[model samples]
Target: MESTTADWVSETRFGKWFLSTETWYREVLSVALREMREIAGPSMPPIRRLLDVGCGQGRSFELLAERFRPREIVAVDIDPLMVRIARDTAGRCAVPVTVMQGSVKKLDLADGSVDAIVCHQLIHHCSQQAQVLSELFRVLAPGGMLLLGESCEEFIDTWSVRWFFRHPPGVQHSADEYVRMVRDAGFGVAPRDIRTSTPWWSLWEFGILRRYGLVRSPLPVTELLLLARKS
Candidate 1:
């Protein structure tokens, strides 16, 4: 996709704030991470290879590395500054993390190479969400998990809500739409709620979708967490 220098800077500013402030980052990311772990389950095998798309500053991968003990973690982002900061953070944390400066829609990795792929709040920024999803599916191994967390499209049902989303310039998708897309890409959907310690700004949902044909009851809430696996 075509991106201007300003777009890169805007993304960088957002990433900087997230990495610099513990409160803002933890408040949201912590919930997402917890939900992901729950879906993964404690008995799940150790993740040998993992990818964090739009890995801004590599904070999420850092958390995952500590928990899953993945042998190798690749973090990719479009912004060079974000990639640099992520590399530095990995160095400081002593986590074996590899940061790449590139777009998720066009990954440099080989097909079916990763066991798990995690993307947090980065889909809203992409102009080609479908293409990005396709690329994600292509790179994922059969039975590999794809966890995505982002703003709920239901937030735009009203004009006031739509205004808020537009001001921030995020591409929102309804929970149902997300599930449908994942299913179309050959995944099973897992149901879960996305909650946070903070109420007002809480935008969290946890759903697990697998490549298998397992299906769960639909959620009634507006926001959701989606988990899908590639078959």
Candidate 2:
């Protein structure tokens, strides 16, 4: 089946190469996995059903399964190849994950069916980001949490990423822009719920600054993770 969208990581040779490797699979995704458990902390409801959007290769399967221990995990990805890999890998996990090919703009699940959403590093790739945000709100059960992780254009336009990755034009946004978009979608967000981060890898090509001790303690933050709740 032809995809309704373009510029996905699965479409390009480099994208496939990067995603199929251990470096990008675990190490790259681990930065956001650290926030997953925190998003599913004691404050939130006992997560029963989970959805991992953009769950390529099911790299986050073990982490989400281990942390939330949800009864079921529904993994969704637009790429058919990724969906296949995810389905194949889902069995390795103790938690049951139903892998499906679907776009974030239009999820196939029922309204308010999921207890939590692990939307890591996926939104910037989407052109219809507002529709995707609204869809997240629609699928999440009341009081459900969304662990939204994305890097800003500053990070995306970097030499390392610009060369290897191809994102949808006019889709990238700053941390505050993403926060506002999430808030505008009717999800409740607080100062504490939102988080801004600067991953070392985001500035990997700019290591000369760090090496020269020119980079300050807090390097330029290029990533944003907002934990929004369906109110």
Candidate 3:
């Protein structure tokens, strides 16, 4: 048996707590929705078409619908199983959504087609993060926004994470490095566009220290959210 970087985004992993967990969804969805709104601000243009990279089982379709309300939401995943689930989930949404199975590194979509792109928790899985970043930038229309959320190497190196997940070590990046890559990909990375966080899940990696008052504790840089725009 052998494992590759693609295994990280495989169906078996998606069936696990990584994509199926209720708490994880709540935590990510809360921040993603809020940050996206804040990034777009008041004078934002109407989002007609949106591309959700690594949509994985369509977990984000409902959230995207409620927040951005794109007239057509394109949900994409590397796994076929997830793509099927995404299509089913999108079919159920009030918003017209399309689900496709493809890699962000080389998307089949036309250039500058999507109004916005939501790429979350996906960059680390890419063997070629720059290619994916470039694809994201290419697909976004001028003045379109890109909401990118990812866990840095610091978080991935934690004992709990190292035990449960498999990642390509070479692709991992720190919060600063991740932001730099996005910037180098031609995105407008402002100071305000970059944000780093230690989520509650990361605070107590195993949930062992959360209830104790003895340790208000070592909060690792588990997450980084960057809301960039294509100009």
lDDT of each: 0.67, 0.82, 0.79
lDDT tens digits, residue span 22-73, model 2:
7776566775777756755676568899999999889889888877778999
Top lDDT model? 2
lDDT of 3 by residue, 167-193 (tens): 666778899999899889998978977
Candidate with the greatest TM-score versus the true structure: 2
User: What is every candidate's alpha-carbon RMSD to the true fold?
Assistant: 8.5, 2.5, 2.6
**Deviation (Å) of 212 in candidate 3:** 3.8
Stretches of candidate 3 off by over 4 Å are 1-17, 204-218
In each prediction, how many residue pairs overlap at the backbone (N, C-alpha, C within less than 3 A)? 11, 0, 0
TM-score of each: 0.76, 0.90, 0.89
List the candidates ranked by lDDT, beginning with the highest: 2, 3, 1
Q: Which ten residues in a row have the lowest lDDT in candidate 1?
A: 202-211
